[model samples]
Target: MNDDLKQAAGISFIEQTTLDRATIRTAYRPDYGAAPAYKSYPDAAVLELPRAAWQLSEARIINLLQRRRSLRTFAETPVSLHQLAFVLWASQGVTALAGNHLLRTAPSAGALYPIETYVSLQRVEGQASGIYHFDTRAFQLRLVVEGDQGSGLAAAFLGQQFLGQASFCLVWTAVSRRSMGKYGDRGVRYLLLDAGHICQNALLAAEAVNLGSCPAAAFYDRELNDLLGIDGYEEIALYGAAFGAKQETTTPLAGR
Candidate 1:
């Protein structure tokens, strides 16, 4: 193992740190002021996604789970707008609101839901190639930056050319203050685990739609954050996944 891995392993043991009691008390305290459950881009143009008449295929949840795999190669065909919406919904769609809290498809610590989903569209039908923020509350996509970002995304991902070729890539960012405010330093762990839940949902959702997905944990952090126009300190990129139609003969996951 490398020095970084060795150092990380040394500190991996669990122990009660100085902030344990204080952080736990703060997290469980009632009536604590919290950040809004959703992030909004008010100035951007919102393209309301198609909610009626979804074209999703019939696939057993067990079958989808069994077939899930990291798909790096994608066909040149474009993903439909409906399919795009379905994947986004599965990943971070809001199901209901209870008082001040929003319940999502994935569970979150304290329902703080710190993860934000962004997309770099390369080949989605009825959508321009650009960066968009998934507005979970509104069920719309707020276009952030206009124009093609395929090559830039690939470069930011350390020359993972397949990322640029995929129909769209999901970029997940963690808003530190959302979790950290409650759990203190321990919130960092929650942030990562929450991201995993979101990504797994994306993967299974994509598979159900005959689309393939590949999760990527390695990338140039500063570069990706800059590309997504997020300050690395406050909201930073944590994970990413590329999705597109699977090549012929291999059969797209949706058709199975």
Candidate 2:
């Protein structure tokens, strides 16, 4: 019965604007070498902690979960490039060693990796404000929308005030063909599920790094797709999250 309902509603909800009419071509290329290189072992100086302090445990994860919350207000303080990089790596960083397949903090439909991350930077210290595509395979950011496109995010979130002040906004988009080829009509559910998992990773990662954020599921899909130069139908926006320094402390992980 659920499958039948999904199929019936899919036609109206899943079908989107055609790609050819929606995508905006650009001379964008991702920069991989610009990111900081890791030496295979954690550096005490860079992490700002003792080597033993970096170890993770079930208690640590639970503590982080307890402290996690949907932080809406952010201070004007800028996030460092390292913080940005760490969050990106935690959310969708490659982890698998065999087959050279990139693993995310989330599960995917047969590991097809349909999710594409697009970033809207506003107040990062070393990075300029603009839209960037996270090249998870290479662990780098590709320039997409140039200049301070923070105002554009307001349109994406239906003029929400919280988004306007966010240091950065993460947009999750799907390459439908990647999943559709495997699951047919059922692929749509997989795409949304994968998006949720990735976003949750980001939220937790933000907490781990002392940054705060929240996922924004309600959005103007067409506007977000247009700003990111995505075709609403083929490669579409599935979810979004806003991150920055918290303005004040609140109940942790309350919104998740």
Please tell me which predicted candidate would have the highest TM-score against the true structure: 2
Clashes (N, CA, C under 3 Å) per candidate:
3, 3
Question: Per-prediction RMSD in angstroms?
Answer: 16.4, 15.5
Worst 10 residues of 1 by lDDT: 10-19
The pairs that clash in candidate 1 are 209-254, 210-253, 210-254
Please give, for residues 1-256, the per-residue lDDT of candidate 1 as tens digits. Answer: 1232223321222111112322444644356779999999999999998745544563377679889999899999999998899999999999989889889999999999999999999999978999999999999999998988988888888778989999999999988778866786677788889999999999999998999999987667667888999765567688899999998865457865
lDDT of all predictions, in order shown? 0.83, 0.79
Q: Cα miss at 68, model 1 (Å)?
A: 1.1
Error of 1 at 74 (Å): 0.6
- Cα lDDT for residue 188, candidate 1: 73
What lDDT is obtained when candidate 2 is compared to the true structure? 0.79
Candidate 2 residues 221-240, lDDT tens each? 77778898977656778889
